[model samples]
Target chain A: MAASRERIREVVDRYVGLVASGTAAEIVDLYAEGATVEDPVGSDVLKTRESITAFYSALEGLEQRTRLLAVRIAGGEAAFHFEVQTVADGVTYTLAPFDVMTFDDDGRITSMRAYWGDDDMTIG
Target chain B: MAASRERIREVVDRYVGLVASGTAAEIVDLYAEGATVEDPVGSDVLKTRESITAFYSALEGLEQRTRLLAVRIAGGEAAFHFEVQTVADGVTYTLAPFDVMTFDDDGRITSMRAYWGDDDMTIG
Candidate 1:
């Protein structure tokens, strides 16, 4: 198995599209109905499509900026490390550690796990 | 495939042993020879057993503290997201984002990619 930057780009593109265009559905499209999202410590595990949608709906005005730090693929799997920045509730939350992403054959992100500090740490 | 904390604990245990015991070889035992580790953004790709060992060797006296945030195993793979703290040259670095780890059937980490800020963001 091998991973191509182009493939990863497509995923990133979709995410960017979600932010630049401010389309909530775009984020929904990238995930399966049963997709899961977790904070840096995996404390807040959100499951199902509805919660996922609600999750994005609440972030209506907080734009997201993603930096493609690195992408690599092998053995039929790939991982993307990135930095995410956004403003929520007048607070800038910059989780700039890394998030490991894995996708299925269809290029849909099966899991999005962030690596950063606990809830006490916040940055712009 | 499913993941259990007990299983994940073993891996973390080995890593912790490497740190608490200060035995370089213990760390080596946790990774495959060809294993690759990237900084939070996937930069600084280090491959091979020797380099991995050398990588840790350089941090001889530095101490590392790991907090087990969350872990899930569905399929044959698992992801554990947690925070890492260490001090270097009187500076404390706390990469509290996360790293996604995949393991082989033998339980050795196949890949470890950290998620945190780029080199510019350093915290204790």
Candidate 2:
């Protein structure tokens, strides 16, 4: 059976929460083994589980919070607008990216492409 | 030269405004000659200008309004969350779709895929 809309919404919520507080390993677990991640869209895609883990690992120890501003799911895929605020060395950086993801039947993410750029980030 | 971030944002704003009040021909002028549109994502793509124009023509005489809730542009591409409210026969239908679009250096849209399912729509 195809992934249900409820299931997809649950996963999107979980993903945002994990990005805020869970370990990188925990976030990586949400994806299928061969999932691909292309955060910031124009960047190189991270294809292997190891690389994907590394990508999220960068935030493992950061002081950050995330909010899912909005999400639209259709045909086993979701496009979400989310905000990530990170504080380091007494400065806060905020970026809201629009991410598109496709999921497998089990609701595991198959691919993710995030749309944001340097110009979108604001520092305070 | 690549499309600038400001240009992309301007285009996004114009596109939303056009959806709300412009004619099908006016909206089609925002695309390149060979642009493609796949509204609601899993549907058949409209590749030619004629087909794309036909798709938007459905809204020509409708009592409708649109709002751009959010948009993120990166790498000459944009993903936007927008709301469309239509009233017909004394009933109002509202649907918000997350649309992803790629543009050329001239800021003309090259392709678009909208993400929204029947479950996301509401009637009042």
Top TM-score prediction, candidate number: 2
Q: Candidate 2 on A1-124: residue-level lDDT in tens? A: 7688899899999999999999999999999979999988888999999999999999999999999988888778999999999999999999999999999999999999999888789999
TM-score of each: 0.49, 0.93
Task: DockQ for every model, please.
Answer: 0.07, 0.79
Give candidate 2's error at residue A120 in angstroms.
2.3
Residue A25 lDDT in candidate 2? 94
Please provide, for model 1 over A1-124, each residue's C-alpha lDDT reduced to its tens digit, 9 standing for 90 to 100.
3335457558866664464346567787887557787754346778888877787776567666756555434332344445567766777676544445666666777777655444324575
What is the TM-score of candidate 1? 0.49
Clashes of each: 13, 0
Model 1, B69-92: lDDT tens per residue?
Answer: 554343334444555568668777
For residue B83, model 1's alpha carbon misses the true position, in angstroms, by 2.8
- The positional error of residue A54 in candidate 1, measured at the CA in angstroms, is 16
